[model samples]
Target: MSTLTIIWIALPFFVGFISYLLPRFDRIFSLGVAIASTGYALWLYTQPPLKLQLLDNFGVTLLLDPLSGFFILTNGLVTAAVILYCWNSGKTAFFYMQTIILNGSVNAAFACTDFISLYVALEVISIAAFLLIAYPRTDRAIWVSLRYLFTSNVAMLFYLVGAVLVYKASHSFAFAGLRESPPEALALIFLGLLVKGGIFVSGLWLPLTHSESETPVSAMLSGAVVKAGVLPLVRCALLVPEVDPLIRGLGVGTALLGVGYAVFEKDTKRMLAFHTVSQLGFILAAPEVGGFYALTHGLVKSALFLIAGVLPSRNLKELQHQPIHTPIWIALVIASFSISGFPLLSGFGAKVLTMKSLLPWQVIGMNTAALGTAISFAKLIFLPHQKQEKQGKIQPGFWAAIALLIGGLFLANIAYYEAYSFENIIKPLATIALGWLAYFLIFRQTTVKLPRLLEQFDHLIGVMSLMLILLFWMVLA
Candidate 1:
């Protein structure tokens, strides 16, 4: 098991490095590696959970429990999808290399049990992501990537400080030791995770980065990478269940704000990016359900971003004039519905399970977000004013990704039938209906202008810092 774990972690990095040397066949080689890696991860699921100790004195370890195992598998699937999508996109060898390294780093982050290991994995992911975001080399891309690099470093500072504080008190870097640390350290840690997790204010860098990046990169950023932060937060929640309510409240706030901004967004990718934050709210409020939600969202959101990339225009009004490919449209519709909590879909199942234990206010907030999602996505169904020539053939890899995502949506409901009942499906159906109705009655003809505060990085960082202070006070008080 330890050997297998090591192989899984190191395979991508090795392949990535080798691919750089074989530039002509980089795409083919990376694709093959992705497929094999994903297959191996799935195979690992059949075996019992495993814990491997890589270092004795330094406490370096990898624990593949149910939570980490699920995330690892999901990461593998998404990485394969990303590689496939990029296979024919004419990217350079360096792009392929970075993608592979990014996948390995995320997998390592998921598998690591110690804080130091997790931090190192996260930093690798951050560096890879920064490079990927800047891969386009456009002025805007460089600016956005730089902003992400700076903000993430600041967030890491918070995490390091918190880790240091925890080590000082507990004298260990493992989660078990950190369980006894002070609330101040925990609050600092949560703040950093929230930043990386793409929570509204804390994750202010998300929208710009997700909206501006290359299609495949955007998919990975929104889908798999952001979850790296949430994984640790889930661990923290386990250590301190008392903070669940605080986390839930912050999640609700992030969700509502995300929907609010998404409702007014005109750029197709930007709207989807905001919805990422909103969906994350649901996950934070219910980590158990979050696993399924994150998995479903990662797949669906990646597909949507890819579809957006192929579109002639990203503006909703302009999109209504361009002829869209049938498979792309089908995938887009399914993904939109999945995110909006249509009954019998992945999002619906996750929402049902998440709401089962929520407070009334939280339930109301979630339903409202659902309604907002429905209203916001309604624009997608609008047909072009004039029919035009269909776009180029959709890639086989993209089609495969869509199919897998749709399958995951169905499986989320079927596999979790023990937690999902017929009664549980009712609310989401009603919510969807209400959302469409509201869209028709009100938002269809009107557009609200958002302040576009996210683009102002300085303001966002200040606000994020204030929120962290408030969180510390709330937790310590």
Candidate 2:
């Protein structure tokens, strides 16, 4: 089982190499490799000691525990969706690069249990992400990729320093062993994971990088890759007994930050990107409060990212200007509503779970997040001017997938107590209402300008994160 899992991790890279050698059939290569990898992951999950040692002394290990299985499945689903969407769109050599990198990294990430292995997997994903974003060689893509690299590298530095501090204390890289180490060492580990997990203020790189990517790439990055960071964070939160407060605080801060950026974001994709941060903040806050809440949020967010890519409108102007005659257009609206947390949708369920689990402070954190998302997506109302089209129906297969996922999300929210609660129902609705009201108050008028002070908010947050690291060092001293 372990060997199979490792092969699953390596499969994408092997296929990617082949694709590179034969770039003429990139789309076919992408789809075949993705499907095969997904199958391998599923098979690996079904058979297991649940743990496998890859390099025993080197502290490299693989795990196919329940948590890892869930993440792998999510990654597979989202990646498959993205690959399917790219079928009609012309393929570039970069598509193969992005797909291969995304698959290999995500597979390696979920399977690996050692800190060093996880770090290596994450770096693999990060480097590929930089290429995908900047592949067009356009000025915008180059600028965004550079910004992403700069911010992510800084985060990586902090993560590495924390890891070294942890190694000095624990002397082992395995998560289980690390958890058994001194409390101080465990704290350092959490700090490192927090940076990787895209915690609120420290995760500013997420919005800028993801929102700026091409639509398909944006879907893959937001829906699938960012969560590579998230899965580890979730695992860390679960393993470290004393990290609850710190993680929750980070969650609240991230949620607020995401909302703030989304509120003022002018582009549709950028707005969704900011919302990704806020939504992730909600997911992070969930497990800290206890229960299986994060899973639903993770699944729903993946779907949302894919939906955002497939939707006809690219931006606010396009949405408003484009004639909504196609069946795909309707599906897009359903998807948009679902993501924005319309009642009875999958998002509502996730939001409910979060609200039910949250303390007042946490609730406040998520409410602000929802409000920001609502405002940002509201910008979509202005989707650009295009020639009108009579509404034409879409293919059954596409609509079927959307409907099925939406329905599943609803069922998971309503039927599964481990993931849902009556308490969740009340708070999520309240948050949704508050979000809607906030959108009306702040975003209804297109002229509302965010303070210039907040324009460089990413830089400010990064500096503050640096300060936090310094403070952590001082406290340890």
Candidate 3:
């Protein structure tokens, strides 16, 4: 089992190097590799949890528990979807090579049992992501990708310092003695995680980055890569459950901050990007269900971003005029409903569990965010729908990606679902109805103007610096 696990972890990197050797068939080979990896991930989910020791002297090890296994399965599915979406992208061999390396890095990061291993794996992911985002090498792409890498590296700096402090206090790198670690170190670690996880103010880089990158790259960023921060964040939260209240408070603020932009934003991908921040808040609000919620969000969101890939324009003013392919429209409707907590779906089941754990104020905050999601997604779902021309055939790979997510959605609903009551049925319906009403009203009346500072790189770095100081002060106090 350990050998198979190692193979599963290394499979993508190996196949990717082979793609480099045979550049001409890189696309075909990448697709084949992605499909195989997805199957392997599912197999891994069925096996009992295990740990593998790699460097006993350095205390480096890999651990796989239910949480790690959940992310492993998620990374595989999201990666396959990305490759399938990019199958006809006409990218160079280097592009596919970087992608598979990124794939392996995410797998490694999720499997790491120690802070240093996890941090190193995450940095590798950052490097690959920077390469992918800057694939065009245009001035804007380069700048955007540079900032993305810059922010990620800065966040990791906080994590590294925290880890060193933790080691000093606990004399080990593993999670075993985390309770003995100082609140100061844990505070710094989670602060970094919050930024990487795309929560509110610290994650302000998300909108510009996710919106500006190429469609497949955007899907990868939102769908899988940004998730690198979440596993560690949730892991830390679990080991020190005393911080649950603080995490939940941030969750509420993140949800509000995310939806505030999304509700009024005009750019389609940018709006969805903010929604990503908001959805992470939903998971943070219920960290115990982090694995399930993350899986559902990853699948549903990648599909949405892929659909965004095919659109004529990400701007709603232009997009509403163009007819959506019937298939794309179907995907939009289902995904939007799934995200907004409609009945008999993954979002509804996740929300049901989430609400059970929330205080009254938190529940109210979540409902407000749900309304914003509905309002924002209305931009896509209500667009004119029509059939495709005979010559314009949607690729089976595209449908395959959507099919996998839809299936995952149903499966999540089944697994998490308890029972449905009248309020469960009516509440989501009311939210959607009210959201659409508010959308139309707001659409005619005014536009939500985001502060220009949010887009400035200097502003983002300044905000992050401010956050770091505030975090230290709070922890020390």
Candidate 4:
């Protein structure tokens, strides 16, 4: 099992390194790595959980528990679809190299039980993602990637400080070390994770960064990369069950705020990016079930971003009149509807779990976010798809989109396997109906402009800092 874990973490890094020597086979190498990692994750999931402690004196360890296994599966599935989509396209060898390296980083991040190793994995993921985001070499791409680099370094720095505090308080940096730690310390750490996880104010950078990056990069960003910050929080919640209430508060806050912004956004990728934040809120709201919640959301969100890659326009209004190819249209609606928690889909199950044990207000907040999510997705599923008959010649990357949708649905249902109760089926229908009405009545013609100052780098930093201070006050009060 340890050997397999090593293979799971090393194979992508090894393939990526060697691919530089044989650039001619970059596509083949990348495809092979993707398929292998994805298949291994799916297979490993059915087996028992495993953990390998390393450097116990320093509290460093590796984990393949159900939480890690579930997220690893999510990462692999998204990477497989991305590699397939990028195949035969004219991406540079550097693109494949960075992408594959990031794949390794995400796997390692998910599997590590210690903060030291997890932080290392996240830093590597950041560098690789920065390179991939800047792959186009355009001025705007470089600019966005730079912002990503800056924000990531800042957030990780906070995380390191928080980890140091943890070590000071409890004499360990492992998940087990979090016991008896101060709330101020945990709050500092959660704030850092919240920023990288794209939650609320700390995540304000996400909309611009994701919307500006290339489509494939956007898919990777919102889908796999964002999970770097999320799983650790899940681990913390598992280890320190006292923090569950805090996690719930953050999750509900993030869901409502993100979906509110997404409802009025006009850009296709931008809107989905906000939804990424929103869906993550749902995942966080149910920390107990967050493994599968994150898995299902990650897969569906990745599919949606990749579909946006092939669209003719990023503007919602423009897409409304555009005649989409029929099959592509179906792919769009399924992924959209799935994310909206439509009946019998992956989201429906995930959402039911998210609603479990919520307080009255939390439940109301999450449900309202669900309604907003439905309205936001309705823009894609209903608007300009009326042409219905335009069977234009299949575009490039079309089949890859279909594969992603089908694969995501299959994994969520088969691996996660949440049963459909009568209540689960009936609840989302009312939200869906309300969403439709709200979309037509209120959100359809609404145009909202967020304060520009809030999006600036200094402002984003200020918000994070203020959050840390507030967290400290709350913890100490």
Candidate 5:
């Protein structure tokens, strides 16, 4: 690794230690460290990939590719935003710990090349996320976070077993070297990674934990943390495209279930969390059908979550009752549109790219996923505070986040026009219209009216089935 890459990993650790040692000066130190790290990550993205061999005989290697660079940018960008958002929230030590560790783990995941290295990186990220999500010590927070911890630890166990199997079968831990081994090892690797990636039932715990956390923490969990799974999944895609038919089926099932769950969810944050799992399903499905839409989905989804993190409410209820008519609500509206694939939004480029990249299996299955996402976010069309009240001025950090989000829009437009066609834009718009219609018919009423039967059953099934599903996917897929 180059000096810059070394700093990329080291800066966060330095800041984390400093914040821990001197908790009084956390905000200043935290913001300074986050901005520097984000700036460094962006700079690194523009440079050539640095290759390094860490373990000699194991052939351990590291390289920064465009996909990894994109996520690195996301991890840094969102970490900076969250830290800034919490600047005056008076929880400096907690925020610093979560932010610094989250950034470090994400950077590590992006840089790892060997299974052992990747596993360690992911474990760090997951644990840091668990801390962030459960930072608040309320009963609900503890219960939800414990659920996240249990599911993630189980996923880690699956990963370890797979690593041992691969080592026994391939005699090496490097992803490249392992690829040259038997296809069965590759299959096992995918199975393990899929559990981490939050496939359907395997990831049932995601929605509960993600939505129950604080806004900034939820943003980290959604924008930077969840993408950790995608990092390994994307890399593994090259090795194991045909790991398990059940994995692909689970991807589709998760996509469907996520949308279904989100469509009826009353809480704003929980709905957003469900969408994350749903969106990941789409990404997982894409690679299965031999397309790169999964990468597109991951990037766009990460950006959307970062923007959503800055919103002022945890649910439609809060946004509805709280005084809006402020710049922040407007910004949130833009984010909703962007996530919903509105015309001239970043999501539009991503959706168009995804549609173009699809094969037969993806064309139909993921099309539904897109429409479901549109419907889930459709509540946003009428969801913002309808009435006006005394509003506070937007913070500088809020503006900073908006600027970054709008910049993302410009980048998305470039991607679209470079690969653009009239037909591409038309199809996504038509699908959006279709989604609007479906939202009116199926989801409009029940979204606000909580169904006791479904909610109870989801809680029961969601909690109980996650482990079984994860193990089954690991073994069968």
Candidate 6:
């Protein structure tokens, strides 16, 4: 088991290095590595939980329990899909290298049982993501990547300090050890993870970062990387259940704010980015079932971003005149409806799980977010029919991703069948209907401009600092 764990962590980086050295076969090599890594993770999922002490005196440990196993499996599958999509997309060798490194870093983050290891893994992932975001190196892309770097660094500073505090308080960095630490330390750590988790206010950098990058990069960012933050947040929730109320409150707020901004978004990618924030709100509110939601969102949201990438234009208004391929069109529609919580899709199951423990008002807020999501995506159904243009066949990787995502949607239903009742399924359908009505009544033919507060990096940093101080005070008091 230990030997397998070591191989799983090292395989991506090793393959990435080989790809960098042999640029001619980077795509094929990376694709093969991804398939192997994903297959290994599936095998690992079927085994009993395993723990290995890498450095006994230093307290470094690797643990693979059910939760971590689930994330590792998701990471493997998403990375494979991403590699497949990028195969024919004209990415350079360095792009493959960074993707591979990021894949390993994410796996490491999920598998680590200690705080220091997790923090280091997260930083590695962040650095790789920053480089990937800046790969296009356009003026806008560079600026957005820089902002992401700065914000992520600040969040990590919090994490580092909090880790020190936690170690000082508990004399150990393990999750089990931190269970009894002071609330102040836990709050600090949680705040740091929240920034990465796409929580509202703290995660102001997410929308631009996710929307501005290349489509494949955006898909990975939205689909996989953001969840890195949430994984630790889940750990925090387990250790410190007292924070559940605050998490739920912030979750609902983030959901409403995300969808509110998304409804007015003109760019297709940016709209999906905002919905990422909103969907994250549901996960935060229901930490108990958050993993299930994250898995579903990661798959469907990645497909949505990939579909956007394949489109002729990024603007929703221009889609009508664009000659979209039929399979791509079907995939886009399925993803759009899935995200909007249409019945019988993965999103429906995730939404049901998210709302299972919510209070009445919280449920109302989530429903409203769903309605906004529907309204925003309703624009896609109006795709203008144009004569089919002669185009090359879509790659097998693209088809594979779409099929996996659609399959994931149905599989979620089967996996959580006990959670699905007539009422639960009916609610999402009703929500979609209300969303369409709300779209016509409120959002149709109206343009709403978001305030520039979130766009200002300095202002966001200041707000984040203030929130951290307030949280500390609340805990200490």
lDDT of each: 0.79, 0.63, 0.80, 0.82, 0.66, 0.79
User: Which pairs of residues have clashing backbones in candidate 6?
Assistant: 320-384
| Model 2 CA deviation exceeding 4 Å by range | 37-49, 177-195, 288-329, 342-344, 359-361, 367-434, 451-467, 470-477
lDDT of 5 by residue, 1-477 (tens): 476666677778787888888999877877777677667656765677777775487754677766666667667666776776666667858668667877887778777878888888888877777777677878888777766666666667756766776788677787755545554455445545655666665566676677677767776777667777766675665555544344455567778878877888877777788888887776656443222233334334444455555556666657665555545556666666776777776566666665565556756787788888888777766654544465454445656655664666656456556545677767777877888898778776663554444333246345434545454455443
> What is candidate 4's lDDT per residue for 125-192, written digit by digit as tens?
88998999888889988988999889978988998988898889888788777777887777778887
Cα misplacement distance, residue 183 of candidate 5 (Å): 7.4
Candidate 3 collision pairs:
none
**Highest-scoring model, TM-score:** 4
Summarize candidate 1's per-residue lDDT along 209-285 as a digit string, tens digits. Answer: 89999888998898889989888777666666777677778778888888888887888999989988888887777
By lDDT: ranked, best first: 4, 3, 6, 1, 5, 2
Which model is ahead, 2 or 6, in terms of lDDT? 6
Candidate 2 lDDT tens digits, 406-425: 55466645544453456655
Poorest 10 consecutive residues by lDDT, candidate 2: 391-400
RMSD of 3: 2.2
Best by lDDT: 4
Q: In candidate 6, what are the lDDT values of residues 59-155, reduced to their tens digit?
A: 6788777676556666766777888777677789999999989988988887887889988888898899989999988998898888888888888
Residue-level lDDT tens digits of model 3 in 1-477: 888778877787888889899998887777676666667666766777787887565667887777776677777788777777666756789988888888888888888878888888888999999999999999999999999999878888988888898899888888654578887787778767777778768989998999899877887788777778877767766767666676787788888899888878888898889989998888788778777777878888888887787777788888778887787788888988898888878878777777777777788898888888888887777888888775254554677777877788888788765647878778888988998898787753466677768668788777877777766666555
Candidate RMSDs in order: 2.1, 4.3, 2.2, 1.9, 4.0, 2.3
How many clashing pairs in candidate 4? 0
The Cα error of candidate 4 at residue 155, in Å, is 1.6
- Which segments of candidate 5 are over 4 A away from where they belong? 177-192, 244-250, 287-323, 384-389, 392-396, 447-477
Error of 1 at 99 (Å): 0.5
Please say which candidate is ahead in TM-score: 5 or 6.
6
The Cα error of candidate 5 at residue 432, in Å, is 1.3
Rank candidates by TM-score, best first. 4, 1, 3, 6, 5, 2
Error of 5 at 178 (Å): 4.4
